[model samples]
Target: MKKKNIIITGTSRGIGYELVSLCTDAGHNVLALSRDAAPVSGLDIDNCACFSCDITDKRDVAKVSEFIKEKWNHVDVLINNSGYLVNKPFSKLKMSDFQDSYEVNVFGAVAMTQVVLPFMKKSSHVVNISSMGGVQGSAKFPGLAAYSSSKGAIITLTEVLAEEYKETGPSFNALALGAVQTEMLEEAFPGYKAPLSAKEMASYIMDFSLTGQNYYNGKILEVSASTP
Candidate 1:
C-alpha cells in the first residue's frame, strides 16, 4: 500500500482513536487531533503525531496547518470526526446545547476543511462523520434534536461541496452512521444495546478513507448493522 498523509479530528477516544491506531500501524503519516492533551499510547513514535486542537477554533487549526506545511506539501485524506452531543428533551434544550453541537459538528468540520484545503491534493478525499439521527425522517429519537439538526446541515454541506469541487477539488462524502456500541451511545441511551462496536465502525471508516473514497464521492451513506 502506498503511504498517505492523513489528518483526523476527535482522536481522544472511540472511532477517532481507533483510526489513528490503524492508520499509523499501517505506516501512514497521520496527524491526530484531540481537544485535550492525551497521548495515544502504544504507537510508532516516528509516524504518529498527536496534537491538541479544538476543531472549532481557527487559531488552533492554523497552528496545526502550519505544522503540516512545514513537513508535507499535500494531504491525502481529511476526516472530520470531531463532534459533541447533548441528549435532552427538546423542551429542555438550551441555546448552549445547539451552540456546542453546531460548534463541533458543523462549524468545526467546515473550519477544518477550510484550513486544510490548500494543503490537500486535488484528488484527496474529505469524509465527514455524520449520524443516522441526522438522516431526515429516519428512526425518530428524542433528545437528539440539536445534535441531529447539526449533522443534517453537514449532510447537505457534503453534497454542495462535492458539486462545487467536482471539477477542481477533492471528493466529499458524509457517512451517516447508525448506532455503534460507543460510550456516546451508552450515555445517550442508557440500558440500550447497539448492534456494533466502535472498532467495527472504525474499520469501515478506515476502508472508506483509504479506498472507498475513490468511488463514494458526494454521497451520504447510512451505515448500519442488522439489529435484533
Candidate 2:
C-alpha cells in the first residue's frame, strides 16, 4: 500500500488511540489530535505526530493548519473521530449540554475540515465519525437527546460538504457507528458489553478512511451489528 498522510481527531483513547498506532504500524504518516495528547504521544511511534487539540477551539485548529503547512503540505485522509457524549434524560437536559454536544460533534468537525481542505486533492478522503443513534429509524435509546441529535447533524453536514466539493476535490462521507467497547460507550451505557472492541472498529475505520471515497461520497453508512 502507498504511504499516505492522515489526520485523526480524538486520539487520546478508545478507537482514536488505537487508530494512531495502527496507521503508524502501516507506515502512514499520522497526525493525532486530542485534548490530551499524552496517550498518543507516549506511544513514540516513528511516523506519528501528536498535538493537544480541542477541536472547538480556533487556536488549536490553527495549530493543526500550521503543522500541516510547515510539515506535510498535503493530506490524504482526515478522520473526524472526536466526539462528546451527554447522557441525560431530555427533561433534565440543559442548553449547555446541547451546545457542548454540537460544538464538538458537529462544529468542531466543520472547523477541522475547513482548515484541511486547502491541502487535500481529489483522491483525498474525509471520514466523519457519527453514531448509529443518529441514523433515521435506527434503534432509539434514552439519554441521548443531545448526543444523537448532534451526530445526526454531522451526517447531514457530510452530505452537504461532499456536494459542495464534488467537482473540486476530496470526497466526504459519514460513518454511523454501532456500539464499540470504549470509554465513551461505558459512559452512555454503563456495564453494557459491545460486540466490537476498539481496535476491531479502528481497523475497519482505518481501511475505510483510506479507500471508502473511491466508491462512496455524500453518503451515510450505518456500520453496526448490534442495537445501541
Candidate 3:
C-alpha cells in the first residue's frame, strides 16, 4: 500500500491513541491532535506528529493548517474523532452543557472539515465519528440528551458534505459506533463492560477510513456488536 497522510483527533487516549500507532505501523504519516498531546507525543514515533489542538478553537485549527501546508501539502484521510460528552439528565442539563457539547462534538468536526477540505484530493476520505445513540429510532439513553443530539448533527453534516463534495472530491461518511470500553464510555455508563475494546474498534475504523469511500458515500454505517 502506498503511504498516505492522515490526521486524527482525540489522540490523548482510547481509540484515537490506538489509531496513531496503527497508522504509523502501516508506514503512513500521521498527525495526532488532542488538547492533551503529551501522551501521544511521548511515543516519539518518527512518522507521527503530535500537536495540542483544541478543535473548537480557531487559532488551534489554524495551526493545524499551517503544519499540513508546511509538511504534507495534501491530506489523504481525516478522522474527526474528537468528542465531548456530558452525562446529565435533560432536566438537570444546563444551557452551557448543550453549548459545550455542540461546540466540541459538532462544531469542532465542522471546523476541521472546512479547513482540511482544501488540502484533500478527489480520492481523499473524511470519516466522521458519531454515536449509535445519535441515530433516530435507535436505542435512546438518558443523560445523553446533549451528547447524543450533537452527534446527530454530525450525521447530518456528513451527509450534507458528501453531497456538496460529490462532484469535486473527498468523500464524507459517518460511523455510528456502539459502546466501546473507553474512558468516555465509563463516563456515560459507569462499570458497564462493553463488548469491544478501544483498540478493537480502532482497527475497524482505520481500515474503513482508508478504503470505505470506494464503496459508499454519504452513508451512516452502524459499527456495533450489541444494540444500546
Error of 3 at 49 (Å): 0.4
Alpha-carbon error at 115 in model 3, in Å?
0.8
Candidate 2: regions farther than 4 A off: none
Candidate 1 Cα deviation (angstroms), residue 28 = 0.8
Tens digit per residue, CA lDDT, model 1, 1-228: 899999999988888888888888888988899886375644545887877898878889888779888887789899999878889999999999999999999999999999888887667999999998888877867889999999999999999999998887788999999888887778888888888888889989988988866787799998978531
lDDT of 2 by residue, 27-124 (tens): 99999999999999898888999879999999999999999999999999999999999899999999999999999999999999999999999999
Error of 3 at 105 (Å): 0.7
lDDT of 3 by residue, 124-194 (tens): 99999999989988999889999999999999999998999999989999999999999988977799999
| Stretches of model 3 off by over 4 angstroms after superposition | none
Kindly provide the TM-score of model 2 when superposed on the true structure, using C-alpha atoms: 0.98
Better of 1 and 3 by lDDT: 3
lDDT value for model 3: 0.95
Clashing pairs in 2: none
TM-scores, in order shown? 0.95, 0.98, 0.99
TM-score of 1: 0.95
A best-first ranking of the candidates according to their TM-score comes to 3, 2, 1
